[model samples]
Target chain A: MKKLLLSGMLAAALFFAGCDGTSDPALPPSSDFTVTFKALYDGQTLEKFKSYDYDTYKVNFSRFNTFLSDITLLKGNEEIKISDIEWVDFTPDSAFGNLTVSVPVKFKNVPDGDYTGIRIGYGVKPELNAKRPNNFQSTHPLSRENEYWLGWGSYIFNKVEGKADLDNSGAFGTSLVYHCGSDAVYRTYTFNTPIQVEQGAAATVEFDLKKLFTINGSWFDMKIPANQFTSNDVGNVIVATILMDNFDAATTVIQ
Target chain B: MKKNNAGWTFKISTFSAVLLIFLMLDACKKDDPPVEDRDDDLVAIPYNPKSYTIPKPEIFPEVPVPPDNPVTVDGIQLGRRLFYDPILSADSTQSCATCHLSSGSFTDNKDVSTGIDGIAGRRSSMSLLNVAYVSRPLFWDGRSPSLEDQALRPVEDPIEMHNTWANVLDKLKTHASYPAYFRQAFGITSRKQITKELAAKAIAQFERILISSGNSKFDRYLAGDPDALDDEELDGKLMFFDEGGLLGLPDAQCFHCHGGITNTGFSFFNNGLDSVASLNDFKDKGRGEVTGNINDNGRFATPTLRNVALSAPYMHDGRFNTLEDVVEHYSKNGKGVSNEDPLIRQLGFPIPGTNPVKYSGLTEYQKKAIVKFLHTLTDIDFVNNPDINNPF
Candidate 1:
């Protein structure tokens, strides 16, 4: 009888402890707010050209898919960690000049303070990256792409496709890939808005892509000369420097 | 009353004796080792210490380990057996050692490795020396990233071993000795336990054992032996690293790709080889096929010049037979054209009457000196060491 009583008491204690552990200490009174992300592109076009079969040219690339994730309402001077935010999937569609992307964000554990600016980058920062087990079974996109093993990637984060005026017929077309990271290209942006999401509220930052393309002159041609994407390559460095320094925060909202 | 009290004391003493025996038995039970924690009896019979010497590196972390497959004596022995055993092949005619011979810098002398059924491979075999330090993936196209992934390709490849995964597993299970070895090494008891994953791990473990870049005259000099290198070799060394004297030669821009102590950065470039008039018809698409990016076409990873003097038939195509031929290829600024990298500068001398075909500006003497310096990178101990040979 004594043993049964002791076991029963222990089981009850453990159950209560587990229940208390799960009750979220972070959630506060729910208040509503909206957040949106936007993708930008060059507004150039190539008209009066007949479309041809796509298999001839081997090298095809898309735009830079930078900005892995975004988090808001962080503590004063707190760096955003990639683990804190979940990523949204980005599929490419080049029918329009620009790809506008927006994801609503929810904030938790907010202290009463004014929040200014959102930080973003080309990919998850190396420091916060999860270690991939060196096995074949785990099938993450980064792991499956063997190119990623060679310190580079097979696809650009984003892609910009257009026709090039190479032969002067205004006919021959080429695609430009501006995705940046590592030995390729890198993109980073900081926002200008100082938002305040009081003890129980949220805020939004809207991104517009058209303004970014015209920041430097639009004549910065995207067609890279064949096999020259090194650090010292003049055109590559110029594009990389411009994108890294001032593309994200320079957005002009359309809506 | 006293006699009654003595009887009571005797009973208490007997009870204490029983309790002490119980405590001892309980303690022994608690001390028993868990099955997983016990020492494994399957340790490889250590060969004579002299016969199987482990060549220690002057620099620690000499061989890079895939954080998962650590260096274990058992694993390496198992891998060595697997490496030499032709059972990996469908016909059991070719072992890994058949192509990657220990005496030949881990590469066969053939222009391209031959596989089962007399099929010829496309490219020449690369030396496996210092593969652990390779920054990028292996192969001309930068295919497999890790050694484990790289080790499995030739086995199941149609032109190579010509074996399927299921058949290979069956072969190992049927083998009288291999099953026991696998069980001993991996603690997997079943005869049908061989899997592709385990095969890769074992082969990689053996490949990791092949690391060698020690005992060269240059290494001795670096180790503070002032008398190791002759005066001419020392002069060559000076011209190689002196950014002003060597780096001044336009073609001496060898430092850009072959820079730092490793003497080679694992980067791919077109190198003007693809600039041949018929380049559009070239069969090997190079980095473009891997990346699907147009910019990377005709590009191949730079091979290390460590044992260049010994490992002959150089480059991805293996067209240049001798070191002098290779030097001359670079001397002519490498058949420059549109897809050629910008780093390929003009090489030929400015002639008195007419323009020497614009080249990498490498004077004949400078090229010779650079080649001489490359000889210093060879590690004699690695080449001569008997312990690294396939014991089976």
Candidate 2:
């Protein structure tokens, strides 16, 4: 046993020494490249026109936050895998109004290879996302972790929550909810301009919230409908698709 | 002649002394064999640490306590008594131990848990073991963030304990034994101090003591015990870790959902259970109700796989009665739902042309091996613990 131990140690030492003498240290080489992805939104109008009186607007985005297993870096037509994409929710106050969720993506350990474009999605995959409870941190808002108070919704790729005035009803209400989840909430955007990216780095695509309401030749008005945004609305699906489109266009290649 | 006789006697004395010394040395060397060497043939007897004595309190991510509700010896003692006592119930006929028995892995061994008045709950009662180390959200739907918050839900639910906070507090305040215990745990004797909030905190503190992640067979092997597991068990562990499916797929993808040292990612998943009928047929709307997203309709939180060998009737609905059944469910790309996750579509084993299903690639024996590895997670100490049992 003593001989075996000694021989094993000697063999390991020799093997390590040989490798150290022959092979160079594998430090990731840095390079410069631009990564871009569009921040798309629907050109849908708000309900009651010319009303910004409320402190918070609840935009009912279709559930697009779930089913996100990984986020990728798309260059032109090719997809590049980036390991680090941390999404943070921005709350104006304790009431959790105006949820500004940001996904900070870094392309760490990628080698120089690029052409055009960028693509990223929210949430994991289906087999993972299924059979779950709502709310990000814990089961209840009060029980949630201090850092995860904003709660991570499970639906991926679409958000649909906002007040809209149908044919000028003239009743004003405030809403800022944007629900995005898995079911039928999907979109694919082909960018006009292709973006480039290199290895060992990453870039982010930040979508502007205000532009999401005003993009399609109309302004987002505030008006409440009879129904509180329920789980199975087809309109939520449309809203989710438009957001995916907006994101695809809003992506700017970072150099 | 006398000189020759003296030399011969000296030589004989030296030889006898050398032999005596050798015998003594051999006797000292045989004092005690290693504990492992003596019990090398013992099967299923864990490589228990000789140093292990007391059960350490496990620290978990969620179960919060107000600065006032810190865990103490008196508090744990009082909570353990209360947990075993039926006084917390409306009729005083059933206690927390009725459903959460220690022998049944802290879960009532039934498909669905029965509450006060024999009311059936929407879901099965989950095991309370190792809950302290859980970083994932609580409950089947991931609702109710902390254990303190979760404790109150079962109490208030009409189907559960059937006792409201107002009544529960009043009962505890009036009880002869409970008031004194409460006074020791909390520094107050008044009914206001013994509110439902205090009850939740005390119960949560006690639940935190029910930590189970200890020296299991698998843990022993991982901790470098060469003889912790038999050959077959070791092979199963290797197959479970490797991407090659064990039974149906190329590698037992059990590691994917049930990963990490504790096992189970605490993530939510739909394992094709809800696709049988209408999406809303189940009571839980999953993440959909919370996010108001239709896509999250059938999702539920993944339970910890620690002690999974003992905790049967797996899945959120408790539909799969056995571990093998659960494996079979995942083998087929979970009941095909429209917008079924792409990851489910990708399940497959290394060996080709077994099932012809692209994703689920495992062999029959590999599945059994993976199951064998899972059995090693059972900690006998936890199963036979005297402290976590009925203190009252």
Candidate 3:
């Protein structure tokens, strides 16, 4: 009789425990992190739309917009995706202005953990890339007017606009516009640097603009025959390839 | 006896607990009614929706269709009727077909189209042949986002239809067969639901049905017919498609703007028609007016040469009356305008009495060949397609 009573008590306890387990699973504590980006001219922070001298040429940028997507945080074999997709506009005319630079992107619900690296896709995700701007919501980043070339049936992933003094006359003469797109030009950059985040604390990541425009320590000349602005041409493709390669090579995680 | 009483008490408690749980589950089930009963208020109406599948031509790219406005047989029929009806105009004398004649490849041969009020428009009517494939901005000025948006403007433009949307809608609502046509096309319950948006969508559907003749000499050549074009036409084809070295000839730079099977890309460029001192000096402003950009001044969208042989007078203002004149203008390499396309600079055509001019890098014989090649793009079958003709 004592054994029967004890077994009954134990079964009741087990039933209550099972009910509690199914009611609500505990979620890992998370925090927010802000990733900041800055445009530079030869390692110096840039003033928006201002002309800067480089290698016998004076350049002034009017627009610079890029798609930074699928930002992932890595620690050994484990990975945590922080952002699905975000458009970073470096144009001075952009709405978000924090000092000279636009507002930094803040990611929420990042699980508190130690990260050893960061990865950023320089273009749109493949699934979304296949669709035209008309297919997306009007307010979506991909739906920005003039970003998608309907004739090419592709989105312009990166739009860098400027004028350059090709002859070094101190006057901007030639248009320096590089509108890079096409799925063939998409690239992902990974930075292997240690970063840690505690619950409720924010972490920051910085991208160096000087490195992005340089190759093997030499600045990429916008006036090169293959780097000129074109919507549909082999030259545009070459310029896009060089730009993506430079992005992957020059990107570094801020410690 | 006390043990028996305790056992009975436990049984009664367990029975009550089971009954309570059953009642709770029963209540949950009652919360959601059957799917059929939930929508009892909605009336069921019989609908036989007809499907339309556009014919795919050989060597042609897939037609672009807006997601919200898929082609339908009923919709196309309604659109055809609406297109031919003069009810869209303030006066009953002018219809879309009035300006766009099937014999002229859906373009009026007039330099500028005459409106219902006998007023002439600024730009000539553009050919509708293969217009559905245009991915760039619509109209010569690159205004309007899509064919649907383009359809809405002609009715209200004071220079064209000279009618208001409100008046047009009223006319459509009062028409004997229009409300029924609208119902058949869009499944609207009442004539009151007929709107300008739906009308535009229907008209766009009809416009999209106008495609090029797939049996053009160039298309036939692409489709493995070696004998389709003669040697002169073939040489012209090479010159037209040349990107510096097709036949070891100097690049005429024709294909830079008019390449691909469509023979024209969708982009606006100032081909140097006017020599303006500054961008503000351009009289027409063309694309610049629409975009409000100074650099785009005098830039006009490139028109397809598919039925160019038929749709003349040429250029945005219909300045070139003949194909020879058009070719000559290009051969002159355009008067050096401030914002002229970089590609439009001198092509080294030596003038007998004057300085070497920037021509189209084509000899007289080569220009003749290019003109012959332009003729092969004319498709006789497209202008006579029975399905695209007037329904009335």
Candidate 4:
């Protein structure tokens, strides 16, 4: 045991000495590229529990959360994966009526460069979605048991919960819940926007929850009852598909 | 034979020289194994404390242990002794077990907990089951952060244990058996090394191991035991979990906040216990007082329902006596406070005639069935576990 311990220590010392400062190689200067997400309603910063106009009717959302994975910055075809699966909750905490609950997600170590655009794989991508909550450590984002749906065998990739004012009588009584999940509804969108990564360079991705329901400049027709995407019904699937499709339109990159 | 001149001063000088050189060689990397700044004065005893891992089913996620305070068998035993000993109380009339009894599932089954001075606290005693899994900022108002911190508060709180840590430390330092126990648990060299921080750590270790055995009827049913639940219980389980498909069972929506394997989401919510005109109107101002945010006025942390049957008089204030009253509160869809969670008012039950205009509620039988399902969550083994009992 003494010989083994000595040998191990010797090897580690030699290995570290080999990579010492004198033997360091020249590399491009790197900087931390911080990518933050801001929550918006229509175009303004989102205020939780406040009513917003939806064409004719009004709506107020209490919760908005989504999972993003395989976030890559694209320069021509040279892609650099910035993040794996991450959970973002835009819902302002119940304590702050005036406090904006938006927090930025920061990534470290990116070579200084210019990029044409960025790509984001929305939701837990297929490989991760295949596993359940217990598969990961409790600290992992996917281990949130409440976010997983046993019936769907998938994580509820995005949860939009609130009440819709069916009539303009100021009572947002009608519940509006759209828990979109399942592998079939996962989307990967590429936004061709300008991005420059330098020292202390920062960028943000803004998402307006209103635009999700308003597809192609039209309101989400309230032809059906509340609780959209409550089941695997074809109508619900179509509604979920519409919501997923408009994710790109609802999102904008601010550099 | 000669002594070879290797005296105590020479040995100390060699150690000091080696330490100085090791410190000066900043580029040389060495793995951290022997913990830093260990006291040389403390007498060494057998400190081979058996490391303990919280036993949880694979379906239930493992609770994170703080890197500094790992759970150990000797530590838990010491904590259990401290938990039951009245040496922590001001009057020597109470211990942590006075309010958090094992039969009551770690609660005193009282509306408000009385302290050593016979003064009742405003809030009810909370159950400590599965408390290690709780999120940041522990307590109903989210005041303390970790179990170690929470264990430290009640000792100083005027309405609970009502004793100073100074007094408690002095007693432990001079106690008949505690110093030896601490040495066995934490490898402390002397009784003088004992501090409130180490005491809190040992208590936290004991609390973390207070996990459920996970053999409840609900657990068995989910584990594919067909005979685990009765007809009503099965219906209640389906309604509670919202799994009833073509059968068209009403969504009880109990699982919204009270979901997960431990029957809790560990998040704060305004379940609308009161009908306040504004957020500030709440008498308690639960999380608001801690955060100084008016919107968070009435919100409280969701406690685990692992042994709900044993933990009676529920909620932060012990407003309800029976499980029926608790279920009834949810069925009524809260008091309609604006800051109340948006989903709180949405019980998803059908209304026959509108006595209240806000939202409809569950039927009579559905409410009973849901209560029955809650009963299946009771783990008799947890209450009777000898490992968690008071060592005294």
Candidate 5:
């Protein structure tokens, strides 16, 4: 009986040793999970040249890439931070995979519990935004090729490139290129939703680009001449303001 | 007693196991030393220390130097020789100074510089005056990140020097003076260590010394010389600075991009050069090609206006033959493009009893005054400085 009891205690100690010391007797055991992000346009998954009716014109996205960083899960103010930054490229030829419409961000060793909400920064955090691409590790999202505006001394937080046909001429004549950046434009998005994360089960979140572009019962008119934004103060501020206003309403937790 | 012995043995074995695991983990965590630290592992060699201090002109900002490649007297001298020596070329008939002549403010007078093979380059040579003050991303497109990186490109460019770095290295290794020069400059033990990196560093050191001392009329005026500038020049300064309310003159809108002592912010802009329906319609992608971004199409780095009078055939492509042509282009504003910078769009003065016209915001007299003010930035002492001259 004594030997059996000693063996049991030894096994329990061995099991606890493998953990990172964050395990609590009151809480459930930690587990691995993933948060999958989806990009949608007009309530449908993104497709190039898929005509989306706006206020006065039809729009189609040829390219869309955004930097998402500082992803955190809040369990009643108990912050579970993920030290990973991801660049979600919705373009057809994205290196993540061909025809991949959704990006899955994995979280390991997460304390299994009920998360009140998830907080994610839309772009690089302000502290990390000032650093140039060359300063980051080559594989880091901040080190993306052609994403940094060297002259402007900032990284393009989001790139939404496409065309618009104002007159419905069947030809996408008007070019829409909104390269948004600047430390002043970095935004944080919080989704207030109950998320029951079980051990080894994945939670999903969806980013609806359609809702993001919609404002006041009208779609954002990319055909506006001034809307062809760059990294300059006036244009970038205009585009960034529109994006921030619509982002909170658009994002939703699917699971 | 037996139970006590068994407990002691178990405790000792468990402690040994923990110690073994920690040792293995520590061994696994060992990482390679940093590149700079690894250099110390090499055999030591006798290094002759020689420092080169760059003269700071009151008009310009403090020059930035790379930590790895410190300026040295031997490095600058070797770089000066290499700048003028045709030995770096495939045919031994051309050098960096061939295209960047000191007389033309380090720019070839031709619209496009001709190489050793007489093949013309796509873009005109840029002036080297006050280049040390330029921050990251050199060249018209802002591709190369440093002057050291910029120095290595022309040597191997097919239309330029047309020589491989290996061939150039071999030539330098065989040369009697270069091996010793490399030794003194970089503290290299042998000629084999004389690499393109050291060569480029030397060249960069020499380029850093090319500063525009505050001897120009504008510099004198800033130095509290009340009569340094004439009334017309002062009016032009006001127009350039766009202090219209204070000077009671029209703003030329030049200070939006070309402000400060360096006369440029060194940022890239489309400047409304082309009116293409699509972003892909640009002839020379400019910064767009370097960045691979469609929005950056037709954008080029803003060149400094210092010594603009001497550096003729301006613009990246050298389309404008003179400063007047440049002034005229700005006066008309550029052919508006879709990606044209907002700052470059529709700048003009309000005509009497008419809607504001699109063009330069300056009147004809204001344009002349602005041109005269630009001439005040010409530091003849900089162009004529003998220290930066070619050393054969």
Candidate 6:
């Protein structure tokens, strides 16, 4: 009878605890992380249809979009994941002059803490890249029909599209499209800087798109038009490699 | 005594006949379906809405179905009927099919469609074939975002069907078949519950089902059938897709705007259609008028080339009558305007001092081959799909 009474008391304790409308004590307090990715030309925010100086020519960017995967913050050996995948679209419907053409990816339930740095996997990782659009639902970001190239048997990892006025003439004539794709083009970069993830506020990380066009000191020449880079086209692969090598230098923590 | 007995029998027989008549009348009254709402009339029909899986090309992306309006079998049927029915028009002489015909891959085969009031619309009737996956902000100007919203426009368009929603509602409420259809499709309890939104939803469901057959020669070739395309067609396909760039063939650059499985991009582009003096001088101001952006002048939604061979006269205004003409137009250094897509300006071979874009690189033979290749995109199976045909 003592054992039965003890059991009943335990059951009552569990029932009342569940009905208290309180969260589990075991889980840590988490906060939302808002990471804004900006596409830029040189040091300023990139604007579509606006002319910018590239070498001797004036250039215009029509599109600049990339898929950032496995965005995680590093705290020593520990990692806090922000997003598995984000289709960062810098291609605005209209031109925004001075302001950054950017998209913010918000992640909720991020365990608040101070972090060493952040690591971003550029392009869909090998595992997710293996699957087709049909593998996922329509709502999945990777299910974009236009991004997936049947020729490459993979998603087009990055699109840096623009036109260059080869001559200083008024008309912008030359088209340059460097749509990098394939497993070989997939890469990741770690920005090794202190990042703090607080409970109420968001810690931002900025990726400059202009850095993708340059490495060390040299800038990618837009006059060299090799539009077909969806697959391992030799002419395009050379161009794509130049840009992919610059990925590490492109990103950094803003705050 | 005998006469009294006979009188009693006659009276009993008369009473029995009257009782039987009364019971028969009562039975007849009970058998009639109860008028739930006497004024508007209840459509007494079974409302078992079966889910519909819109036929999609295996090579294509997932068919985009809005969250609120899940497709139903009855909904599709009702939509199909409405699409072909002329009753939606003010004059009862035109329908959605008046502009979009199935045999022509949902194009009326006219340069610009003449509306019910005999007025010509500014743009061509875009092909409804494979429109389910069309990158959003639909229509040439990107004015309407959803097919449901787009379906509502023509009926009310002064030059088009030229009918008000009020008139359409009244007609649908009183429609002998539509009320029953509404009950089956949307589970409307009464005919009065028939709404423009429900009608539009039904039509949207029907439009979503109008997808590609994916049995085109290009699709077959991509699906690993090596013999699907001929030598010339293969060459054209290679050039069009810039696969020939590896083989030292010049990038035709058709895929820049018209790439992807559906042969179209997701955004609006000024495809160098007209040589405007300036952005403001554009006669139509197509996408510009919609967005209020001067840079967007002369831009139109990039259309799919699934059944392009049948969908001429081509372009937003249906300017190009034949595929050959279309190719020639692209070959020429486009009349350079401020916002003309760079792809057009870079059409020709690069020369030393002269703007390489100024010259047309495509030889006469190459143009023909490209046109021949475009023919392979014609999906006869889609055009002949009986499921999407006129319900009438």
Q: Which 10-residue window in model 6 chain A sums to the lowest lDDT? A: A223-232
Q: What TM-score would each prediction reach against the true structure?
A: 0.59, 0.54, 0.65, 0.84, 0.58, 0.88
List runs of model 1 lying over 4 Å from the truth. A1-255, B1-63, B164-167, B220-242, B245-251, B255-260, B263-267, B276-279, B288-296, B334-339, B347-360
Question: What lDDT tens digits, residue by residue, belong to model 3 across residues B1-392?
Answer: 89999999999999999999999999988997643234321223333558786664645655667889988988999999988899999987788888888888888888889898888889988888777877668898878889999999999999899999999998987787887788788887667778999999999999998877688887788778999999888777766654224244444556645645666555677887997777799889998788676766798888888888998988888999988777767765555554465456443232334312213356787778778988999888888789999888
Pick by lDDT: 3 or 6, better one: 6
Worst 10 residues of 1 chain B by lDDT: B45-54
Clashing pairs in 3: B346-B358, B347-B358
TM-score of 3: 0.65
Q: What interface RMSD does each of the candidate structures achieve? A: 12.7, 16.0, 9.5, 4.0, 10.9, 3.3
Encode model 5's per-residue lDDT on B21-59: one tens digit a residue.
Answer: 999888866765542234432235456768877885553
Ranking of predictions according to lDDT: 4, 6, 5, 3, 1, 2
User: Best-fitting candidate, measured by TM-score?
Assistant: 6
Number of the top DockQ candidate: 6
A185-207: candidate 4 lDDT, tens digit per residue: 88999999989998899999988
User: Which digits, one per residue and each the tens of the lDDT, describe model 1 over residues B1-392?
Assistant: 89999998988998898898899999987997643334442234232211122344453123346657765666677788888888889999998888877666777766778898899888878877666656566787787778888878888899899988788888876676776666656666455556777877888877776655557777677567888877656655655543223234332445445543445445666676645554354467776667654445676877666666777777776777777777666655445333454445444333333221233356677777767767888866676766567777
Deviation in Å, model 5, residue B147 alpha carbon: 0.9
Q: After superposition, how far is residue B318 of candidate 2 from its true place, in Å?
A: 2.0
Segments of candidate 2 deviating more than 4 angstroms = A1-100, A103-255, B1-69, B242-249, B276-284, B289-291, B339-342, B345-347, B350-357
Cα lDDT tens digits for candidate 5, A153-202: 56667767666666777655455656676777778878877776666668
Listed in order, the DockQ scores are 0.04, 0.05, 0.03, 0.24, 0.03, 0.39
What 10-residue stretch in candidate 3 chain B is worst by lDDT?
A: B349-358
Tally clashes: model 5: 0
Q: In what order do the candidates fall by DockQ, top score first?
A: 6, 4, 2, 1, 3, 5
